[model samples]
Target chain A: MTRRKEKTELVPKEKQPISSQAGEPTRPGVFYSPAVDIFQTEEDLVIVADMPGVAPGDLNVDLEDSVLTVTGKVDEPDSDWKLRYREYGIGGYTRRFTLSDKIDQSGIEAKLVNGVLTVRLPKADALKPRKVLVKAA
Target chain B: MTVLRTHRFNDIWQEMNRWQQHMGDLFGERDYSKNACGVFPPINTYDNGESYIVLAEIPGISLDDLDITATATQLTLKGERSPNNDIADRSYHRAERDHGSFNRTIDLGQPIDPDKIDARFENGVLEIVLPRAAHALPRQITVKN
Candidate 1:
């Protein structure tokens, strides 16, 4: 028997000013496009993104005019230490997606845990598939 | 004199490794020998005089899924990222995140105090601080006027 993991509780979405344009630069510093995974379940569309070094308070998610944007800010490194070697660049993370009407904007939820952000966009009730029963005459 | 020479050699070797790693990054995800499905988790390392700070971007991983170990001159990180199985019923619109086991070993030329190392994970990032061995720390001498 396979055990299924229980769904995490959803938090109320926060309201923020949405940028007028999608993919437009809004914050300073090097902005890296974080790796993201989007998957659809029976009732929700889940998006998981990797954003290391981003704190909960520094993260912002906004949706406006069918565009969904995620941005994360990272603290600058200490000035006293000089960089002798570098394999990866430190910067903020930004990514945007154009959402469809099938998504229930009011029911959308997001959570950040352990450097990963998971956004759950619940599907509209009207878009869900329904089983039709045949009537025998 | 021999000990000093060995330390210098290690420094040079580490510098070369850094150059190679940077070149690999510049060329994009072509170094499949190390990680076949692209760099599962990219990392950055810094030296802060007294300790070495390493930060790795590994989001979606929980504490139970991560393992870190350090020797006097090397650090190893191993972890597994399980794939999302909840999406079996729906088609994917976009899938860029890679899932599987990952092991990355980093070589720090200067010896470090393994017992004194500190590590913390927050907001999808893992930060590690490795203090240099007592003998490896820089000492300032008083100047006679």
Candidate 2:
């Protein structure tokens, strides 16, 4: 039987861990599948991901061969602190996204604020809706 | 390292849970909460000599919208995440980030000064520092001859 958890909470969603995907990771640390929201408009496709404890400098967004990967490296907590109560583990975040040819790769832009990363991928010229002059018959 | 002692019910429960987790790890059991969802903005607690720090990961939330309350033994965190554009306006390919509001009450296990509890949001994590209550702190009495 598939283990499916009932959705009850309105705001707090559980963190999702990612199993190894494709190539091996160069850095040794725990990885999580960050919660993301993807919205597509007529002009652009926006991808927003939640990655807490990741500074702007620590975030990486790379797109190669139509495969876009987002990785956020988090700083490790001080080891001197003793763990008394535990709910989640300390680690980095990584998720892979496959983009289509319709997206303009050069137009991609992303920014991180308050632990949220938003990536804007503009639609290619061919994909954008063009208004053609209608010759009246 | 000296471990703080508290008689709260949550402390015992957490102790037992840690023990179970330790045993589970020994048996190579898969970690729970991995790929499984839990409460919003999962929290982890840590302790130093002077204070206990509670860290909660909250992404995309403004400090103005968040609320935090603390007592001698418990903490309450409340916040709301604003929704994006109207659902009808944009086509969402994937919507995994849950939104709305969340109120999480945490048991600190030890008595806190409450007045000294300091909380700040940085890099999307809500960090709450709960100092040990004065009465709970240990003091060495000098013996006069």
Candidate 3:
């Protein structure tokens, strides 16, 4: 049975603001916004984000009250040499997405590979289209 | 006296121009490097007295797809990031990732030993270490007692 494909809907930029959680201590330095790509398949919605310098152990993905958040902590390079020239600085990454009811929250999966994080949100079974047989009388 | 005064003014003017150029390189709309077509990967370079370390953010790229070449005073990185082919069946709601080929060249301002350079790619970041040439290393002569 071929299921109808649905287009993935990304949370609008205004709705994805960086919100501070209660009791979470604010760390000094900047938190950069990672570049992301959101797409949908027949079975799931996929999100890919670029977050370099973030190890798998340092990444956190949490879902609370329909809000999905991804955070990665990156430590500054430790070297004794003084910096003579710089083009970029090290920083952490934070991004959030509001999920819809169509997603199966329990079946969601995430993987980190080569500094890229891919999150798959499986569609609820009810949302999956079923092919029905027609009877000719 | 007039020649000296004009020379000093010219020196100050050149200094100001250099400062402006540096600022432009930092905050310009487009990269000042040869790879000006795309801005997928951003790089940072640092000099640590003995070697120059360069860090580039290039997520989603396989190590085999990346190329690096270094000379005494210059380094070049060339790579191509193929777009996700699995997403062909799905429609994109937000497509911000850029995929294409890019070549970036960096001038280290000091001579380095190409044979001593080392490169590593981890978690989507590429790091290159270029050690300064023996002649470029600072040397101190002992004072006679």
- i-RMS for every candidate: 9.9, 4.8, 8.3
Which candidate, 2 or 3, has the higher lDDT?
2
Query: lDDT by residue for model 2 over A24-123, one digit each (tens)?
Result: 7677878888988888887889999999999999999999999999999999778988876666777899988999999999999999999999999999
User: Which segments of model 3 are wrong by more than 4 Å?
Assistant: A1-25, A133-137, B1-40
Fnat for each model: 0.58, 0.76, 0.57
In model 2, the Cα lDDT at residue B69 comes to 87
Model 3 residue A109 CA deviation (Å) reads 0.6
Over 4 Å off, model 1: A1-24, A130-137, B1-40, B86-88, B142-145
- What TM-score does candidate 3 get on C-alpha atoms? 0.77
Off by over 4 Å in 2: A1-8, A11-13, A21-23, A133-137, B1-37, B86-88, B141-145
**Against the true structure, whose DockQ is highest?**
2
What would the per-residue lDDT of candidate 2 be over residues B1-145, giving only the tens digit for each residue? 9999664676887888878888988996646555325576678888887889988888888888788988799999887777654434677778887777778888777798999988888899888889999888778999999
Instruction: Please write out the lDDT profile of model 3 over residues A97-120, one tens digit for every residue.
Output: 999999999999999999999999
Per-candidate TM vs. native?
0.73, 0.80, 0.77
- lDDT (10s digit) by residue, model 1, range A1-137: 22223332211111112343545565656777777778778889888887778898999999999899899888877776655454456778888889999999999899888778899999998989988899999
Per-residue error (Å), model 1, residue B98: 0.7
In candidate 3, list every pair of residues with a backbone clash. Answer: none
